[model samples]
Target chain A: GAGVSQSPRYKVAKRGQDVALRCDPISGHVSLFWYQQALGQGPEFLTYFQNEAQLDKSGLPSDRFFAERPEGSVSTLKIQRTQQEDSAVYLCASSESGRSYNEQFFGPGTRLTVL
Target chain B: GESVGLHLPTLSVQEGDNSIINCAYSNSASDYFIWYKQESGKGPQFIIDIRSNMDKRQGQRVTVLLNKTVKHLSLQIAATQPGDSAVYFCAERGKGAQKLVFGQGTRLTINP
Candidate 1:
């Protein structure tokens, strides 16, 4: 079975540029999640979706960070006007259900570098 | 604000020996806890998880122990192998919460 996968495994964006990171979760997964990880740090929750509905966006740092999972499958995390602070690895995870008990399978992640 | 933290930033253990990593969480309301192992350039991989109701859970060579009284969690890996070398994180989810609160992480090194 294919695990969660992210595209543009490595992205180098100039400051003030816009970047879009994509994630494809495991087939039939009902819950998807996004997280941001800084160097030598654990991943921080960014957003969550159950199907096509955006359930939680509380972890999003600012308005520049937006995510969409339209049609309930592929997800995109877009950062507008990327800043130096936006440089980090963006991780995507999926689980079989929305319940917290299920294990979350994670993608390799997109390493975004803001120059 | 809720936070999860590990006691040690790194640990080194000889191969075939048992290894233990500890984490402390501030949120007593957290009802679910999980451990993850992440290799360089890769996302976190789930290791084991324990609910608030149970104090311990085991999977293969890994064991997770939770102490609700002290808000502590520990992961024990028996007969540690080189493949076990990676950064380990402890994450907690509060009741009815969809997001996971993660700790800084502890790097484990398995020595030959």
Candidate 2:
């Protein structure tokens, strides 16, 4: 079975530029999550989706960070006007259900570098 | 705001030795806890989890113990192998919460 997969594993964006990170969760997964991890730090929650509906976005750091899972499968995390402070590894995870008890399978993550 | 934190930033252990990693959380409302292992350049991989109701849970070569009284959690790995070398994190999920709060990770180094 394929685990969660993310595209553009490495991204280098100029300051003020916009970037989009994509994630493809395993087939039939009903819950999807996004996280941001800084150097030598654990991943922090960013957003969560159950199917196509984004039920939680409270963890999003700012307005520049936006995520969408329109079709209930593929998800995209967009950072508008990327800043140096936004540089980090963006991770995607998925689970069989939206329940907190379900184990989340994670993708390798997209490493974003702001220059 | 409540947060989860580790007592140590790093731990070095020899192969075949048992290892214990500790974490402290500030939120008593958190009802679920999980441990994750992350290798370099990769996302976290789930290892084990325990609910607040149970004080302990055991997995293959791994044990997770929860102390609701002190808001503490610990992960014990028996006969640690080189593959076990990675950054470990403890995450907490409050009741009815959809997201998990992760603590600063503890890096485990294995000596062959």
Candidate 3:
């Protein structure tokens, strides 16, 4: 009955600092995804996971962005050397299946502000 | 170089009137389309979705139309209400692709 949840709803960091955001997907979800949304713009895909396997990471902006879903239930997104361009809302979503047609339930998202 | 884009940045309509939001996708290979609604301080919520094989799909108070030949998509809301005010986004998934490409959102304002 619980929806996807993210930790540290808002985060502020100085330039060059490292930050990690957490996401708790719904129970029994097989597919998880991460996205970055800039202000007034649509969300952009970052990565995807299926049962703890990192299947797609093509959308990661650079080497600084890394994600993991070690146990297949919870996922973490890490950003190293935070840059002003990285300031945006990071959203987490999970679906019942790994198929592209399934609807994804999204989390409230973590807003990261780099100064 | 292909992307999903909206025709308008904002749309205002009176309560009880119908509202329409349009989107254009450059990728003809896109096979799945979805519409999402988002409010301030919240994540996107799925409204409805349609596959490329279907031309239209209907949900509670909302309908989605897809024109594969032209790569156009539209969301129609019946009896628009104040609670329907939010930013609407159209997303597409190319055939066999695992990722969704989202379009610029349309801000819907309901004047009650």
Candidate 4:
């Protein structure tokens, strides 16, 4: 793809319902990341994957939030039993390498509204 | 929590004025830093980047300044236009997974 792409730009889920967001990274991107951005706040890291291996997920916020990047290409962030507090924009980014100095391209983001 | 531009610094400049936005990061081990421009209801667009070893780097219409001693970073935009009006953010990459930690951000409003 030309850039990191996300699906279903906006989502409205009921409490206790499950919602899934997808990400398709640029071709040959080795590192992928997910973040959550609350209203009037900066984006916070959620999880990281390097070529299909989940490395750092310490920032997932809770057990209900999970992300996976299988085959090092596409990724998915699934939230189980969504809560009202979970309403926010979920962002996905991809970088060419797993190095720190590399630039991570970001997607448009999925705005999840938990009602 | 540590904040970047908690009150949202405002920069109202003429269309051709050169705008400078500053940021202060806490970590010293952060080698990767980037400037992002986010418009309303859109994703962040990369502006420019600078490595830890370098103090300054320039792009098409943007420049980034890094001061390791004070952990400060600044972005200089040349010939600001109305389209440049947006919130700018500076992000630092983590140690292991290289996850990005973003600053609070500064809102730039270019006056016509």
Once fitted onto the true fold, the runs of candidate 1 whose alpha carbons sit more than 4 angstroms away are none
Cα-based TM-score, every candidate: 0.99, 0.98, 0.99, 0.94
Highest DockQ, which number?
1
Q: Could you give candidate 4's per-residue lDDT for residues B14-104 as a string of tens digits? A: 9999999998887777777889998878878899988787999999889999988978899999999899999898887645438788987
Which residue pairs of candidate 1 clash? none
Q: For candidate 2, lDDT tens digit of each residue in B19-57?
A: 999999999999999999999988899999999999999
Which digits, one per residue and each the tens of the lDDT, describe model 4 over residues A2-105?
Answer: 99999989999999999999999989999999999898677988999999999989899899998988788999999999999999999899999987778889
- Backbone clashes in model 3: 0
The CAPRI-style docking tier of model 2 reads high
Winner by TM-score between candidate 4 and candidate 1: 1
TM-score of 4: 0.94
Q: For model 3, how does the per-residue alpha-carbon lDDT over A1-115 read when each residue is reduced to its tens digit?
A: 8999999999999999999999999999999999999999999999999999999999999999999999999999999999999999999999999877999999999999999
Give the Cα error of residue B51 in candidate 1, in Å: 0.5
| Model 3 DockQ, alpha carbons vs. true complex | 0.83
Query: In model 2, what lDDT does residue B106 have?
Result: 97
lDDT of 1 by residue, B1-111 (tens): 999999999999999999999999999999999999999999999999999999999999999999999999999999999999999999999998888899999999999
Better of 3 and 4 by DockQ: 3
